[model samples]
Target: MKNSGEELHFRMDLGDSIEAREQSMISFYKRQRVDWTAPLTCTLEGDAAIGDGVKRHCLSSVMSKLQFGFEWKIGAGKTLLFEGEKDHLVPAASQVFVDSDLFVVAGRMIGHSFLHNGPCLTGLSQAVIHVLGGGMPEMASIDIEDCCDTDVREAVELLKGSAELTADQKRSIQSLASGWDLPGVTEENRRWLTEKILFHAVLSRSKGQVKQLRKGLKETQVLDLVTKRPDTLPLLFPRSCAVLYSPQLLLERIIWPAESDSGDETDDTSLEEKCRISGFLREYIENASSQCLQELLKFWHGWEVPPKELYVEVVHGLMPRSSTCMETLRLPSHYISYDAFREALNAAISSVPTGFGLV
Candidate 1:
């Protein structure tokens, strides 16, 4: 039943108060579903134009989804009703969903950028990861780039000198050299390896080249005669040789020996034999030598031949033929694993003095 005269009536228990009745009425009104505003459609004016142009095509495509709608109340009790076109709401909701999905995808892409190890993306990738992981992106990028550049340069140099390098080395060298020319390398690092360093290394290797130049002079007395001639001495030396010598070509040869001789048998045999003999002698001396040389000398009294031959034999026994055979006899392996190995390595390193080990 409805009450008039600016008051409302309702059936209630005796305990019901005005406040309770008002609250109940308010709750009822809220549940009655009064008309409320719906989302308005974004309008697109003029005829829809489609063209081969990508931008116009996209605009026309998006505008096709634009449609308007409203909300209203109906019946004596005032029930909610949805009115006008509702098609646009689907597109609007879809757009929101697509945007959210895109955001997520973008976030993932940024994350992946950091984890990647490629030359181009690694820096940006790490930066994105750091930011996403709650670190400062800018600072991380700087640090990462610095470390990457250093590593890249070192790797490039190593690969440039490596025996096993392929076409990758050439490509890496080109790439890194280009990077070195970039502003990021800085002027200070630019001076690290200069033309002077190259020149000095060339000069040092000049002696080896002079030896090669004097190879034919072994039978001829030209080298000795030149050494004796005061005026010719300086001229006959590196200063004269430099005119004919190509330091670049020489250095390239020394740096990459593989390019010169793939089947150089003398290089393999002589170097390997000498190394083995030197190693064996060192091991023998280390095992045999006592703190008191005079006491050790007493044992050598009965020895007929020179002790050098015995040393040579011992070297041969320790490092026979190949490194694998040497290993079978318990000679040091290339791959060391422990402190004891390191100590043994130290012993090996110190046992032979320079020139003494030469075959």
Candidate 2:
């Protein structure tokens, strides 16, 4: 692969075999820009030599033969692309890899490797290899159908037949469809279309008429979330989109490391701290009204929690506007024990003119 400007762009020559890590090729075309930005595209005609499943068994057999001391599992898929044209090709560069460090991509566990030196572990002598690297990476998936031109055409036709749209909405959709010149509808484009259609329909209606439409849209969204089960919702609409609904899931994902072993002797000190904090918060909110959650949702619906400095600046700037501004701005809870909160309150209180000198 060669770097073309800001991004790496490489083309696979049609009928030329480029050995990728595994399953990295999204859809091969004969020397074409991937989407629109990729500088080079390559196409390989035949299947991988090892394939995904066969590689796994082969790797397992080799590792068992070596008696490597750790249980290993291969990740979903990774691609390693080797340098060569259709006629002349060679294996990619290979390096020695620890058993724990080396995992299979796709189903195939095939790699050009040998037992070397002291470890008596499987090692890559000379070959290009790719596998899921360490640490969690944010992932998103688009269906194969979503990328097909036929699917886009059908979706466009369905939109054309939709009778619920206003004249303006229909026109806007037509305009959007005309400009979607790409062969297939990408996930981004699909999301845009979905959002735009709803947006137009909502805006075109009067206030009362929009309510039912909004409700319907919300129901459909919830159904999609429940049925399809996305890890995270696409940010289709700024204020109206449904995000991941479970705080527990978020907490576990953010706090607890994935693909790790936990032994009785191994203590998660951070987890203990988090548990303590969570317990206190749970106890504090036990007597809180149900409306507390609703109020929080309402407050954050159209706004994000600002950074501490920005929040302090905004509070300080606004405090001087009215003598009773503090009284007017009633928090859901009148009291909270936090240093920044206290500081902001003190600043606001101090800014209000008082006959007695400022504390």
Candidate 3:
């Protein structure tokens, strides 16, 4: 490989793999097949046309190899000369890609190195760019901290306007955010913090989980946990609530574990344990972290219950139903059975056409 002025000169020596843009190939020699590939198609699934004159290709099956927007397979003992525009080669060993969305611009990206394949980028402007992150390469380090800060600040702004937050809840969140030394924090740590803040704020108003959050706020240890280690706040809620914060889990189909018919006892049992709700009281508590409570209510209204009655049952279930009679038949008697409460709740939600969503 050689460089002269604005032109780049390279030799595809025997058995070499050279990737260049589809239209960038100026001249080539020897019998080597030059394959044109779609931008980031190797890692991304689904068909998306990148731009004019770009070929449509599927993501390659190979795991370790990177599918550049285009590729050239040079045969053994073949020597080829290629010339194109000047390009800056970002050394993979020293530098890491961070937030490709900010750096990789369509039509501007000639080629990327084979050293890493992060998230696949698409022709769509909103496509996620897999940001490379490892070492600070020359001229690339200045924007990382700034970008992280901006993203975090934007998420915080969203949190402040969230409808679920009570007056006190908003003040509590603000106190934590104010204490966070955003500028002084490391780039990676900032990303983590940003995720935690957004997840907690969004789930703050989740139905089944709100009571737990209030409970935690009252305990000195839990309050300390909330202020100093906000990341663990989701844990104080039920697993059903905590799992909602996980991006990976939420991406899957939304359904309680007991609702699945996969027939895999082990997996089903595991999911049930993670999201166990045996009765109305437990169900209300467990589902507190769900973001789709309204949607879930709609489902219940359509098939399970009338919304107004479901709402009433939920209110009664939350209160303590069991009381010890000072001289009862020497055994505790229940005011409401779990089955009756669940059935009444379901009937209530199903009867309301609009449900209690607005109420």
Candidate 4:
């Protein structure tokens, strides 16, 4: 019985020793694994607190439970085996760290590109053609396919009416209109084209003295011109007319005169003179009469032995020659805080002469 007890005790001692050796092997392997899998030297802090104590403890506990030669996963279905080489383990750890950051970077780039409003290839091409029409012979001209029928018709009418366009320019425009095949034309496109043609016509006419009529003409006079001779106003005014005349008011009341005051005889005489001038100008424009002769008549009618302020205003407004000049000008927004910029722009505007004369 004693021998039996001794044998049992020996077996138990052997089992305990085997466990101790297994634990020793595991500890040695864990030390080697940590060293091998350490991040790049630049990423390492010499201080131990920079590494989480709880995480290290958990990793060691997991490693101790893992059997030698068994494989385990650390991330996204990637496998790490307990054959335990530092080289293999370090690469896996680096890849896991880099993967998350790479995803974040890629996501941010896509969002930025989506939000960017820089001109696209289509818009760039359109802008080039608009700036340099028919100048680039080698490049295939983009057809004005989106222009509306109304717009095309208006352009044709404007070209026909414009004394500014040379015979050659008129012919070229007509030929372009006849040859061009525009599809899916819209109201907006038509309006856009009409304005564009009118703008070009005004630019062409700007070299002559007739461009002066735009300066200081009251809103009432402008509407009368538009109502009487629609063709001439559109041809002469272009963008400037739009600025001077209100389309909404014109549409609502074709003729709107200013209210008269009964207190002053001078005011009454001035009003009568304006009324006469307005009527005569309307008649002359409607009849397609000569502009030079019409201006001379306007001067004679408004002229006085002693020129009154009203007479001067009338002469300046109706004269064929005026000091007004169109330029690349813009008004600052009301919300802007830059007072200097606003003041500079206003000064430039004021420099333009408001006086007028017959050509």
Best by lDDT: 4
Of the two candidates 1 and 4, the one with more favorable TM-score, higher being better, is: 4
Residue lDDT tens for model 1, 12-83: 121334344333322322222221111111111221211211121111121111111111112343221111
RMSD of each: 41.2, 25.9, 26.4, 38.6
| Ten contiguous residues with the weakest lDDT in model 1 | 114-123
C-alpha lDDT values of all predictions: 0.26, 0.26, 0.26, 0.27
Pairs clashing within candidate 4 = none
User: What is the lDDT ranking, best to worst?
Assistant: 4, 3, 2, 1
Per-model TM against the reference: 0.14, 0.16, 0.17, 0.17
lDDT of 4 by residue, 1-359 (tens): 01222110000111233344334333433231121222211111212211222122222222223312212235544232211222111111133423333212211211111122100111112212222221222232322322223444445565445346556655555554444333222333544444454333322212121112121121113323434554543232222112222222222322323335334344433555545444443343344323332222222221101111111122222112222111001122221233443343334323211111112
Evaluate residue 32 in candidate 4 and report its C-alpha lDDT on the 0 to 100 scale. 16
**Tens digits of per-residue lDDT for model 3 on 1-359?**
11222321222221222333222222321112222121221211121212210111111111112212223434433221111111211111101111221112111121211111211221210101111211122212221112223444454554535245456644544565655432322323444555555433222212122222222232213334334655533333212222233222322323333433346443323333233233443454344344343323333222111122332111113322211111000111122455554554444433222222111
**What residue pairs clash in candidate 1, if any at all?**
113-125, 114-125, 114-126, 280-315
- Over 4 Å off, model 4: 1-137, 142-265, 270-274, 289-359
True-structure RMSD for candidate 2 = 25.9
Q: Which order, best to worst by TM-score?
A: 4, 3, 2, 1
Model 2 C-alpha lDDT per residue in residues 202-301, reported as the tens digit of each score: 2221223223222322322332332243322222111111221333322232222222214433433344333443343334334334333222221221
